[model samples]
Target chain A: MGKQVPVAEGVFTWPSDEPRLIGSKCTDCGNVMFPTQSGCPKCSGQTTETVELGRTGTLWTWTVQGYPPKSPPYAGDASPKTFEPFGVGYVELPGEVKVETRLTVSDPEHIEIGMEMELTFVPLYTNDDGDEVVTFAFAPTAS
Target chain B: MTTDDVAIVGIGMHPFGRHEGVSGMDMGVSAVRTACADAGVEWSDIQFAFGGSAAAGNPDTMVSKLGLTGLQFINVVNGCATGGSALFSAYNSIKSGMFDLGIAIGFDKHERGAFRVNTRSSGLGDWYGESGMALTTQFFGMKINRYMHEYGISNDSLARVSEKAFRNGSKNENAWRRKPLSMDEVKESAMLSYPLTQYMFCSPGEGGVALILARADQAHKYTDTPVYLKSAVVRSRRFGSFEVMAPSVALEHNAGPTVDASAAAFEMAGIGPEDIDVAQLQDTESGAEIMHMAENGFCEHGEQEHMLAMGETEIGGRLPVNTDGGCLANGEPIGASGLRQVYENVLQLRGDAGERQVPNNPKTAYTHVYGAPGISGVTILAK
Candidate 1:
């Protein structure tokens, strides 16, 4: 595989032994958010501190993408010929926020709500620079 | 209190389906002409106007086709609540005594897969879309999945909702999906998102709808059977509420905006859910209808299963919903969607709806529209 790289910068800590999703917590309202927002949505305060979020969370809810999404917006190979269904869901990092992410499994029967899930990474696609770009996901903790 | 005396005098719609050669504005112009004729008024009679479309261009530009009477025309573009917001603007125009008469209009022509949103344009992070997590259907799926698990809603109930939409669509001439499909067909249709089948979702399509509003006291001057606009309310989602296009949600699942809009509509109308004779709830997909029934105060959370099993939402049932078929059948032209509900409600109130009319001469009707970025609008009409 080509040198591993994150799909985008600032979403999570990269090039590390243990990467945790990056987020922001409001100093005023204590409301937390993903990917680190500069402003606090909860308290209308610009005062927010960048923080590393919990790596483990519970699967709050889930569903599978039965069809390939449209491109220009979608970077993955969405051609009908090679498209494979994948799971999408929200994972609740306790006392923080329920982060919407891609799930490791596609079959509905395989996953259940409230299943303990942990942060993981999957190859989204390859960049032109010969780097294997990756994206974040949550998987069954026991898996 | 200044806005309590508005009435819809006339309603018109350009049958919602594919019209290859027709531009969205052309449809809007035709609907405007028909509405004026139905109200027995000339285009010059309207003192102000508010209308909108998403894919379609600025609505105020229609003044060229509508004749340059130089009326104050405002353009609204509130995602799915575009039509409702336009109507609210027009209702207030007359209710506030600023104008004697006005028009609220909406129209749109969307690409076949137009429901697929581009997160980039919405100011979302690029990675959110690039990583294949931007699908709107996924949001609907997760939400319904969670709701069903929490409320004990059977898979069969989801199919039943689409089954009902198709059955009702078959009876409405203007609806796009006219052919009725069985519950089994709904259940068996290719799963677009788990718990939601292909047939369970609405395709994006073309259409236009317009309503003419006047002060309730002067409504009789135009139409003898004026339907009073008892209330028109729009509400946005609170921070903790689970809504579309969210990368993360709050742990505390607060009520969505529909609950707020629904309650406010009933409050402004001086009536409760039980008093509404018939209704049209947003049915973007089968699951939305199921959830909205309770969100709009039609029933309890877990009662949808029993309600679907008993056909309580059917045309002849206790509370007829989407009597002219909803987005699940008519398809969604986001701009025109909300007003289409109001159009159907007006027909029901006037007893002008032919074979699909609700029984016992329905005196009151409610229309609700909910959509992207988490907003809901509700309108109550009374005869």
Candidate 2:
């Protein structure tokens, strides 16, 4: 097993038992954004503050990525022989914003809209330095 | 109310498909020359021009081929609305009383396979594409999936849209995909994304289109049967609309840009949807056609399932849509797709469409095109 590392920095909290995704909130109009944008889209507010997003949300919409995406833009290191289809969806964190993320499910029979989902980290690929590069995802709540 | 004040005197197109040796600029020159011949005007006669393309070289650099008459040539690059923007510019120029005649030409040659977008150029972070969530087809799947869930639309209705596209394509000579397809074949095709089949999507290819615009008062001097441009409008997405390459969406819901563009076009033309005799909508995929049908106000949401089943959108039906095959059969030469719609509508209004002509003389035509980052353009024409 290689050492674990986040795919990118400033996306989520590190070294924490409760890893909440980081986002931004407009101090002017109270709009919420993921990945912490510079300005507020709703009110054009220049002043904003970073805030941790909710850990759980409900699935708003979803689809199966039935084929491997094209490379150059996609850095998953997926080849035709080893690639697996994945699920993509938007998870609404209630009253804040709906964040687009990779779902932990692929089969249409397994996923449903409005299902309870919780944010989790998963290995996206391995780097050349033998580090496991992980990204964010949402999975169906175990209940 | 400025209705029918601008007229399209001539239209021309280079066939849409894989042209092995043809460069995008060559096709553009070919289309412009053909339009000149159709309008009985020389290249030197065009006082100004507007043109664009996504992959092809700049349009303003074609002065060597078009003649050095010192004409004002502006280049437009509105992603997929390149042609519409060009037309919009030319129409406004004539209406502005600055120029009496002008031309709008668009052409593009895209490489094979899916388009590889540059994240930095699109103002997106590297993680977006790096995480495997940037595929265009995936967004379409999620959109139609949510639409189906909300409006009770069926997958069968989605397949029917493609089925109708190919059938209409078979009747047109210049369309790229001329072979008609059955609904079952569309359903059974390869599933690249959920709720969409390979046969249901339009492939990016090569082509060129040009339309000569003249003031209505002077149009009779060139062509007696002029197709008048009643209105043309372009709009961008509002907040809460689901657009391509978005990391998040507002919980608040709103209609897409197509709704606003369609409404403004109808209002500017001083007419309503009921007055349109035929329509040419952006059919990037089968599901897009269905969604646009309602977004453009041709029908109500959730009514598509019944409307598509009743065959009211067919060539011989109540509303003829994409009679010249649209983007599905024409292939999307990004810059040229919008003008292709206008070209087909002109053919229909002039009774020049050989096999795909709508019955009872379609006097008014509506055209709409939607593109990435959420932009839409709508145009209305009447004879």
Candidate 3:
């Protein structure tokens, strides 16, 4: 479930006590990129600092998945026997950055775009050692 | 302004679908042959050529597939606007007095899987690592979220757009998905991306479209009552920024809180939204069609749902849009979709749309093509 790969080096740590995604911020343009870009796209300046993303945000829009994604890159650990149609949505942090992730909610019909949401990590797939590889996901904030 | 600018003399299209047997080059050549025949011209008469395609393996390979015969060939690729980009290239070449005759061909046969990446390129790094960032569907999902926040629009409104598109597509011979759909059906469909159901997104269809552009002075020599290009304008977003401005789509007639490229297009065309008798907007996705209604100045932002409720965007509505059943129904072939819009406008203006035709003869019409991230192209045509 953890690896010290180049993309994850320094910026990302495995099983942190506090779960969050690490992004490099370009102080010049105030732009934050995921998977951490070495430099800012706006000013061509190096990303001087690293930052952690908030675990809570607002749902921008959402829908339920009816089919498996075509690529293996997205194949998750849930067995077809255990697979249930799940909802997905985009959550907007107050900072204007948006991300796409799975939605955890009781009912898909009630999901709306502007609803408040919180982030959680979900296992996407299992590796050779049968360890679960988790990724960030989101769910509706409790009313 | 005296009709010496440009005219489309020939229009041809390959059937839209998942064509596994034919290469993009084969499709483009087939469409070009038909267009040349329709225009009563020989291959040698094509003084200039422009090729458009999104995923043809290689850009140069796709352009070379057209076999230009060394007659001033140009290649253009602008995501979904590939067809429009090609058209614009030929139109400009003729308008610039460089050539009196030109051909624009757009073709595509999308790969049957996730989008590919150029990891092999030396410059690949940074924002380029995650190819998912460029996925148009996710970007539009964000816009839908904002639309919901500002307008309080309901999902039913978005579903209805698909309902209309599916119904129309079912009747279209060239459409990919022929089954008619209901709002409930659309609502229940599998989610491809948040805020975008499978029905809302355009399925990749393999096809090619060819258009012959002749200078205005020579237009009469080709055909009478030629379709005139009022204006062709394109706008692109500032790279490396998250700033979302008003989209430039030309659907809305009223200004909203958002900013778009349509205002400038209207000013250039010397006509307002009210003057447009027919418009063929790029409806790559259902939410996009609804959003375009506001972004293009057809109505205020977030007013699209109510407008749809009133049956305003239907074929017989006050503002008939996507009369040929938009990309959702007709199938989107990326590079060919834009020219397909122009072809539909030409048919409507020429009084040949058949069963799906608009009632009154439309003298003025508009076609808009948008692409990945934030690229917009608006073209005004008149008879």
Candidate 4:
């Protein structure tokens, strides 16, 4: 088996069939934040608990990133001839938070606001060491 | 009632466009000199200076170029709101009776293309940079898309905004994109992000602007046409307001920064949106202008389509906006973008805006600039 690495550690649960994005829920204010938080941003509450986010969400808004963005931090393949456009949006997890995310679909016509989406892992790119780099994205929930 | 009254005695700016050989420092010097000349004051006569820039180096460098005057010089950086923030600082300095005459300058020379923001500097985690969602244009495209869907705005409204920008830009010699673009041309332009064409987005270009401000009582000594600064307010986003650079948003929806900034400005100026005769707004993209119109209380939600259709935002229209062309035509030089709005409004108030001047002798003008992560700065000026 090849070595698999997450795009960023601690963002989502790993090595599991049912991985969920990690978030923090303030015990004092009930405010939730994605990728967890050291303290509540709203009420400055220190008593917070890390919780797994919902696996499914509704697409709040989306757009097709037709052009290759500037690189440095952007590790995606950006060569115009080979570059593939992709979808980006904010997905509202019920009663939690609206998380900005990448979508599995690139075609704008295929996606609609309020559409049901399920979180899944996808390969962002591979590093020189032959580790498969994976990141999270949302796709149409299998009906 | 006029305790905090400040006045802009003079204003100057280098034309907005590509200046192949010119450095930002040289542009800054030129603008400062022009402003001093316009105010009929010598550089030595200036008491203090506050400068704003993102890409450019220390503004204290101006002291070496202008003259070695033992004056307090402060440099500030607040993303795209740098200019307005600098002006706010200057306004407060005079209002506090700390200094009578001070200058606020904004200058930058950015590499052509979409602005590359340093995620670390902007206080984002490494995960955000790795997600490939750090692009500003993508943020704009996403927010504007949702806004369009919720408000029933058509693609035509976006194109019309760009069309009007270029049309108004053609008359302003200082504008970068002076060639008028028809609605069809804007629609047919190459798509950058979904529903946003290349023409709809403003490029990051090079420019510099300077304003000489003084206490109202002393302003008449500098220039007879001193434009009174009624208010200069800057606000950051409240929780739940959507903005660029955030990885997530709160479930609650709070009024964004522009709303808060503009409202504070109107209250300070003791005027309403209807009282603004000519205006300049942040047009980083066509969609921003449409949304900002409603956000700043210039109109109500879903009224941009009808407002644009009726020519209410045109040069001679009832509420002439971006009269000297806006960021769409000026090409945003981040730090200088907000002050560029002030430069145009000053011209409009002084009846010096040549061909693009509004029909009626404009009295009050409003300017707003929004930056990353939901920061907005607003200023009101009166003749």
> lDDT of each model, Cα atoms only?
0.90, 0.90, 0.69, 0.89
Per-residue CA lDDT of model 1 for B295-327, tens digit only, reads 999999999999889988999999998998899
- Model 3 misplaced regions, further than 4 Å: A1-11, A29-35, A38-48, A75-87, A104-106, A109-119, A139-143, B57-68, B111-142, B191-196, B239-259
Give DockQ per model, in order: 0.81, 0.81, 0.23, 0.77
**Model 1 chain B worst lDDT run, 10 consecutive residues:** B1-10
Compute the DockQ of candidate 1: 0.81
Ranking by lDDT: 2, 1, 4, 3
* Candidate 1 vs candidate 4, lDDT winner: 1
Stronger candidate by DockQ (1 vs 4): 1
Off by over 4 Å in 1: B1-4
Q: What is the TM-score of each candidate against the true structure?
A: 0.98, 0.98, 0.84, 0.98
Off by over 4 Å in 2: B1-4
Taking the tens digit of each residue's C-alpha lDDT, what string does model 3 give over A34-78?
A: 445577655689754777766787775555554444332234533
Worst 10 residues of 2 chain B by lDDT: B1-10
Q: Mind giving the per-residue lDDT tens digits that candidate 2 earns over A1-143? A: 68888777888887578798889999999999988888988888998899999999999999888777878778786687888988999999998999999998999999998999999977788889998888889999998
TM-score of 2: 0.98
